[model samples]
Target: MLHGIDLRLPRGRWTAVVGPNGAGKTTLLKALAHLLPHEGSVRLLGREAAAWRPRERARALAWLGQAEAGAEDLLARDVVMLGRLPHQDWLGVPSPADHAAVDAAMSETQCQAWRDRALGQLSGGERQRVLLARALAVGAPLLLMDEPLAHLDPPHQADWIALVRRHVARGGTAVSVLHEISLALQADDVLVLQAGRLLHHGPSRDPATHRALEAVFDHRIAVHAVGSQFVALPQLQLGSDSNSLATSPSED
Candidate 1:
């Protein structure tokens, strides 16, 4: 149901897609990853993504979906090592390079201590990090993450942002669908969606981007400049009832 939803994510940068629920944010990511059927063309690294083999596409761009699950009995590090499968032949054992990549991914994600833990036993946040580590282990130049920060604490969320920055610094590209406008502001670019349409797509610094975001949500949300940071906050939309303050507890 997306319309005119073209996006260009520059290499060595992070782009955050933000929007209300059911705005086709996840659908857009799926389409770009060739996980879902869509009408328009989707290109990765200057070639049509659909033309690539499954293993080739998986190698070129690793996607960390919002609700990902792996074998419950598998160890965390083993799961991360699974990312290297595309580079190996069927029934191939883990090579030294695979081990090195898995170790690096675990260290980067601070999951080294849980390397031997079963995936099913980890907490939600821990599992989320483990999945991200798996994605990182693939060593793909392009990464797509949907709601990657969900269930993460503030510190881990910050760490994830720093990790993304490091990845981009190494000539990688990342596209993430995020709900937190404040955290998303840290990305180099932003794509705002509304009603399955591309409301705006450009640098995060653009005032028009903020305006489109505010307008798309019908001003029920307000975008304000707090120092150098742009924050989107829920604003009360008052009804005609004089006895009620329009704001709900959640809005406040």
Candidate 2:
């Protein structure tokens, strides 16, 4: 449902795609990953996305999807191993490098404690950490994630931010479709979308970026400086008799 969209994401930088419900943020992400049929051109690492072989493209780009299915029966560690399939040969056994990468990823995500457990046996947050570890184990130069913080608590959410920061600092690129506007503001840049169109794309700290963010949500939210960092907070306040403000449910 996207229209007239053309953008060259910044190399080696983090950009968070954000918008209200049905703004096409997830659709745009899937299109960039070449996971959806689209009419526009998408370039990856100076080459057309369609030009690369499937395995080669998988090696270059890692994707973590929202509400992805059918991993419940796999053990936690085995689920992470799926990321190494692109680098492994057909019917090949896990190599030492693969083992090391998996270990490191698990350690980074703090999910090594339950490596033996099935995905369905873990809590939502634990499963998310394992999935994130799987994505990281791919060792790809570009990472795309959708709603990565869905089940994470605040502390782990901070950890995820630091993890992405480390990834970008190591010369990799990151793109995430984030629902948490405050968390999205932490990215280096922000791409604001509304009604399947681009409203603005710029540095997260830019005044114009803040304005576009506010506008997309109908000014129900406001960007404010809180202790030297930009944060998006709710502008709508409930009356003294009201329990809380009502909000419409969000969707892709």
Candidate 3:
């Protein structure tokens, strides 16, 4: 349902896609990953995403969706090994490089401890970490993630941010759909969508970006700087007279 949405995500940067529910944030990510058909063009690595060969696209970009369903019987390590499919030969044997990539990805995601465990046996958060590891194992220059923070606790969320930061530092690109405003603000740039259209796209620190965010949410949320970081808090609309304000309405 996206219309006239034209934007370029720079390389070596982390861009977060954010908006209210049903704003087409997930749709935008899917479009970028070529999972959905659209009228306009989506270029990745100097070529149209739709024009790339399937195996070539897989090697150039990795996708992690919100709910990734797979065989429950597979071990965590084996699941991660799937990311290396594009690089493997017809025999599909795991090369030393593939093993190293999987090990590094699992270690970075803090899921190495559960490498031998079955996916069905892992907790939701643990499964999320393993999926993240699988995405990382792809070793793609561009990573597109939708709601990657789902089922993650605070510490693990921070770890995810760190991982993305490191990836960008190494000249990789990351585009993610995140509901957590504070976490989204940590990214280098922000793309705000509203009702399947582009509302704003700019650096996270720009005042205009914050204003657009507030406007889209009906000003019920306020972005504030907590020390060096910006945090989004619910705006309290209460009467001036304390006694008159018996109840306060909160917006999400």
Off by over 4 Å in 2: 237-252
Q: Model 2 Cα displacement at 200 (Å)? A: 0.5
Give a tens-digit lDDT track for model 2, residues 37-117. Answer: 999799999999999999999999999999777468899999999999999999999999999999999999999999999
Worst 10 residues of 1 by lDDT: 243-252
Q: Is candidate 1 or candidate 3 better by TM-score?
A: 3
Off by over 4 Å in 1: 236-252
Total colliding residue pairs, candidate 3: 0
Lowest-scoring 10 consecutive residues by lDDT in candidate 3? 243-252
In candidate 3, what are the lDDT values of residues 37-146, reduced to their tens digit? 88878998999888899999999999999889988999999999999999998777899999999999999999999999999999999999999999999999999999
lDDT of each: 0.88, 0.92, 0.91
Best by lDDT: 2
- The lDDT, on a scale of 0 to 1, for candidate 1 is 0.88
Q: Give the TM-scores of the predictions, in the order they appear.
A: 0.93, 0.95, 0.94
